[model samples]
Target chain A: MRIGVVHETAAGERRVALIPQEVDGLRKAGHEVLVETGAGVAAGFPDAAYAERGAVIASATDVLGAEVVLFVRAPGSDPTLADALLAWLRPGQVTVGLADPLGAPAAAAALATAGITSFALDLLPRITRAQAMDVLSSQATLAGYKAALLAASRLNKIFPMLTTAAGTLPPARALVIGAGVAGLQAIATCKRLGAVVSAYDVRPAAREQAESVGATFVDLGLDAADAETTGGYAAALGEDFYRRQREALGKVVAASDIVITTAQVQGVRAPILVTAEMVHAMAPGSVVVDLAAAQGGNCELSEPDTEVDVDGVTLLAPTNLPATVPAHASRLYAKNLTNFLKLLIVDGAVRLDLDDPIIADTLVTHDGEVVAPRVRERLGLA
Target chain B: MRIGVVHETAAGERRVALIPQEVDGLRKAGHEVLVETGAGVAAGFPDAAYAERGAVIASATDVLGAEVVLFVRAPGSDPTLADALLAWLRPGQVTVGLADPLGAPAAAAALATAGITSFALDLLPRITRAQAMDVLSSQATLAGYKAALLAASRLNKIFPMLTTAAGTLPPARALVIGAGVAGLQAIATCKRLGAVVSAYDVRPAAREQAESVGATFVDLGLDAADAETTGGYAAALGEDFYRRQREALGKVVAASDIVITTAQVQGVRAPILVTAEMVHAMAPGSVVVDLAAAQGGNCELSEPDTEVDVDGVTLLAPTNLPATVPAHASRLYAKNLTNFLKLLIVDGAVRLDLDDPIIADTLVTHDGEVVAPRVRERLGLA
Candidate 1:
């Protein structure tokens, strides 16, 4: 089996699917690795670094012709890359990436027409056995950790209070909305930075996880019945419910020195939890990190990928926080991808075992069709 | 006595001399407080905010006309504002600020020619009774704390090591050069954020202070006899000593993930601790924060007041870090200024007692003469 890694072409995307450190693992598993020239440069890995680790430095065309190709981000959501990616790939080839098929299933359609087998890594089910291969969790961890740091950097006051000879400084208060992977990581990182942390989530059980990570859980006095879906994500509660939730969260937002909103609804437009009034009420030096900026933002005033000064408050709507720490992001992503790729390597060849739930769920397209049930159903194909 | 505060006109200076919370104390002491319109706006205190605290909002001209005027930054050292400051202020009016006269004695000369009583807060003596009035220590505390946060935020990896489901991440290593107030604070802050911190200083007594606040002191195995001056600052050891110090420190710097330089020699240029070659030897994605940037950066490649990428390392030369966090910086500065201002108020009037060492040391000019001995000596007026 031959594995290929290429340079990412998306704006603000610095992570590569594979790093040179993990190339030895692929070779040990009886696979040849081909890395395009300067593929990992932006992620802090040079061509010489990859070549030193037994990875062949090749041109983009040669690497694309390999049996298996990998990417951290794919053209599934970017319509501009659809034609270019399709033209570069061929039949019987395998592509593995967080293709973002949920947002743009049309990308899967293009892959199907090209008669190639494509696995959308984002579709990997949340299961114990599949934990190692979970690209979403790995990337979300980086995003959440960076989100807390981003808030701390933008804040005017220190996160941790200290009693000095001059006077005592009170620790900054941080409030995290959403108790998912990103939210929990944010809570942990903020705690590590010595902030007085409080987190909120509609799912009642999320309180345990938040509390376990040294964050006080804020429970709004509202019945959030069946707030969590079977997929272990927050269920959409409609506009009326969100409006009332925002109203209830106004006081919390105003009291907090830093607010981090990770209220992403997976494939849907992110819910606006922090309203304009809420943001305006925050202190002049308060900071807000909206992790859902790329998904239309969890705050009303957030402009995706830009930092705005609302009065004196700083609102950072960074679209790709993982890119900001490309070194660690690439490292974790490479490990997750290597874990997934290891599963498909059966006796020095690619194995498409549809019986396994991980394989069946992540396989977005195969044999000239949108074979994944979810993508097929999304495309209205029987 | 009437005290007035106007907006600071210095580049990137946002801190104010007084805050609204401390204005009530001045009023209770039988003094009138005047704040120029928008004086505290950048410091997170609006005109309405000051007005609510019993401060009268006045024009810049009226504020300067008051019996006593306060500033976080003065026209001192800035020739552009010398003539304007001299013209705006009339004789007999008292001006107090961090005049920066130690570094630029010529600035004190301009104030003396105008026949105004000027007090340079930076010249305040390091006595027990004057601890509350030490603006340099107060402002440096903020600068050091912010320096650590800036380094963490710019870093490519998290400061803390965590055993996550993905894998364990190692904590980042931080090195602090010069164990002054700013350096010790940086060490404490980096340690609080979970970075493994090490520090170095030429003064032997500085080791105890650095170690007391969670830092491993680095000794270069060189004879550092007579390293401390009478004023408790590092003695100017000349180029030969600095060359040997940099040579010994090269290995230590290359091993650290983040390096913070606070090696300022008061009233003189900062000694370069990390050279371009040393920076080049460090791992990619490392960060260096030069806190002594305004004094001519401790890193050879550092550009004061800007962020630069040297090879692959991020060198942040932030000037006036206290100004960047104007809200708390103003609060702390106000507390220190108010403490000193209380000493000058007697029988509802400003008292200038030459007997008080605190007053005598800080008073740069009085009665049409450069009165402070240090300023006079530096200006060749002795």
Candidate 2:
């Protein structure tokens, strides 16, 4: 199998789909890797590093001629680039990467029309066996880590307590809203920095997960027994429940020095957990990092990729935070891709095994049709 | 004693000499506290907060009319503002705070000409008894912590090592040059962020201090028996020794993902520990923060208050880092001032006793003369 990797053309997108270490392993498995010029440069992996691992350096068009094409962000994720990318694709060629199948199902229809077998990595199943191939989890970890770091840097005081000859300075208080992968990571990071950390989640089972990460779980006295779905993701609750939750969380937000909100619902607008009034109630010199800014924000004041100052408080809504820490993000993402490829290619050829849950769950378009039922339904196809 | 606090007028200086917490104590000590309106506002202390603590909010001129005036950065520190500040002072008036007496001896001379009793906290002696009054140590601690945080935030990779389902991502390597208060703090901060930290110092005794803070001391194999002065500070080493030291440190600098340089020689230029060539040899996405940027940086390529990118590596020389974390910085600084005021004011009146070493050491000008020996020598006064 000849796998191709192209440089990401999206502004501020620095991650590479395949790194040198992953390319080395693929080469050892007898797969020829073709990387476009400077494909991994922005992610700290230069062309020389990739070439050193026996990956051939080639032009974008030449690399696109391979059997399998890998992308950090599939061109279909951007409607403007979808047509240009589809024009370059040939029938029977396989495309693999995150194409936002749930959010932009029209991209799946476009891929189907182009007769391209597309596997949207964003649609990977949440089963334990598929955890290694979960790009969302890997990328979310980086986002969580970066969010804590960004908040710390923007904060007016140090996170940790200090007992000096002058006096004792108390540790900062950090509140993490949402106990999912990103929220847990943010809690752990804030705790590591010596902050007194607490967390809240809509799902009751997330209490243990939050506690395991060293955060004192906050019980908002609201019934959320049906707040979780069978797939283990948060389900949207009633407006009244959210209103009451916000009212209960107002005091906690006011007392906190740092607030990191990561309450994102898959394929939908992120729940607004921190209101503008709550932000206004927060003490001066407080920092709020809204990780769900790209998905309509968990904070009412969040503007995607902007740092706003409101009455001495800092509100940072940085989108695609993984791109800021590109090296580690790309490394973890490449590893996820490598694991997925093991089930994707067999004996130097593309093999479609719908019986495998991983393949069946991730395959969005195949044989000139949108195959993934959820994506098909999202596209309103009969 | 009527003590006055004024807002810092220097550019980028956000700290105030006294906070509401300190003002409250002074008020209870039979001292009338007068604060310039908006003095502590930038440091997160509102006028209402100070008023609640029994402080009088007044104009800058009214505050300066008190018997003694306190400043975060004395007007003498800025040449342009010195004359205007001096014109407002009476002959018997007293001034307190950091005036850079050693760096700008002319400031001391001007204070003498104005017949004002000036106590330059920057000239505070390094002694066990005077530890509580040491402004340099307190400010340096904030600078160090901010340096590490800035470096971590600027780096393109996360600091901690993680064994995830995707793969194990290794921790970043951090190297701190100069094991002073600032450097030790930086090492501790980087370590808290889970980076593998190492420190380097010319003084051999600094090895223990570095290790105490969880940093592996890097020995560059350069002889430095004269590196420590009797006053317990780094001494200016010969140019030949610096050349050899930089040569030996080149490889270590190249291997580090983050480098924080805090080396400084009092009353002189800071030593350049990391050369531009060494920074160039470092991996792409590496960050170097020069904490001694105000004293002519410890990195060869550093420019005060600027972020310079050499190839793909970032070199940040942030000046007055304590100002960036103003709330805590002001609190710590206020505590140090409170301690010093204990010795400066006896029985509700200004008491200048040259017999006390703490008073004698920090007094740069008194009774129409440049009294500090070092300041007199620097000013070439008879």
Candidate 2 lDDT by residue in tens digits, A10-82 = 7788999999988878987899999999999888999999999999999988788888999888855644557
| Candidate 2 residue-wise lDDT, B126-190, digit = tens | 98988998999999999999899899887889999988998799999999999999999999999
Best candidate, DockQ = 2
Worst 10 residues of 2 chain B by lDDT: B75-84
Stretches of model 1 off by over 4 angstroms after superposition: A77-80, B77-80
> Docking quality tier of candidate 2?
high
Model 1 clash number: 0
What digit string (tens of lDDT, one per residue) describes model 1 on residues A114-171?
Answer: 9989988888888888888887887888789889988987787768776655577788
- lDDT for model 2, on a 0 to 1 scale? 0.90
What is model 1's DockQ versus the real complex?
0.63
Provide DockQ values for all models, in the order shown. Answer: 0.63, 0.83
Off by over 4 Å in 2: A76-80, B76-80
